[model samples]
Target: MPRYFTDEHEWIDVEGDTATVGITDYAQGQLGDIVFVELPRVGSEVARGKDAAVVESVKAASDVYAPITGEVTEANGALEDDPALVNSSPEDQGWFFKLTIANKSELDGLMDAAAYKSFCDSL
Candidate 1:
């Protein structure tokens, strides 16, 4: 699996035609203590670079954008009860949803781990 990131601080881990999406650790840190998450429903279609979900923290609510156009295949129901999981494990259990990719080519527009690290460092 290859993980990619957007400048907006969302991440997607690609495995075959499905991609798991979530906010980055940096994003969670910036958001402060997460209290709520609004996730897209399974079977919903989202366009690349559009808001796919929202996360609310002590600081503010932030949008999580889709890195590629796709149909959502699943949403993490656990988030409704344990939003703090986002702060504890944004890359794993805290993942918002899985999407069946609409266009694989859209993945090329995202930054890899190394590039995303540099991009974060620049902030």
Candidate 2:
């Protein structure tokens, strides 16, 4: 299992120093139908807890935060053509980016799945 989560409701699956990042099921459910996703450029530097991208739904736009400090490696370009993948598979096909983490220690500040669930419950 992956240690994942952010206060912004982002989820991350870290593998070594690289990670795949995305929003949570609860987030997508609230966002409704995803129509557009503005992804960050590859190689962009992102600070933990800062806005890294934007996800726009039929309802509104929300900032997607960097769960950990990292250099963006790739983004879901497929979102440019079809954004519904976010609604159908927020954890899998809808993953937003892959990152090359700058500081592995940053992971310590993130919440694990159990903690994330608790945090969501509190929200």
Pairs with backbone N, CA or C atoms under 3 Å apart (clashes), candidate 1: none
User: What would the TM-score be for candidate 2 when compared with the true structure?
Assistant: 0.92
Which run of 10 residues does model 2 get worst, by summed lDDT? Answer: 1-10
**Which candidate number has the best TM-score?**
1
Tell me how many clashing residue pairs each candidate has.
0, 0
Candidate 1 wrongly placed segments (more than 4 Å): none
Tens digit per residue, CA lDDT, model 1, 1-123: 899999988899999999999988998889999999999989999999788999899888888878789999999999999999999998789999999999999988789999999999999
Off by over 4 Å in 2: none
Per-residue CA lDDT of candidate 2, range 1-123, in tens? 566788887889988889999999989998999999998899999888789989898778998878888899999988788888988999889999999989888878788889989998998
Cα lDDT for residue 68, candidate 2: 85
Ten-residue stretch with the least lDDT total in model 1: 58-67
lDDT of each: 0.91, 0.88
Clash list (residue pairs), candidate 2: none
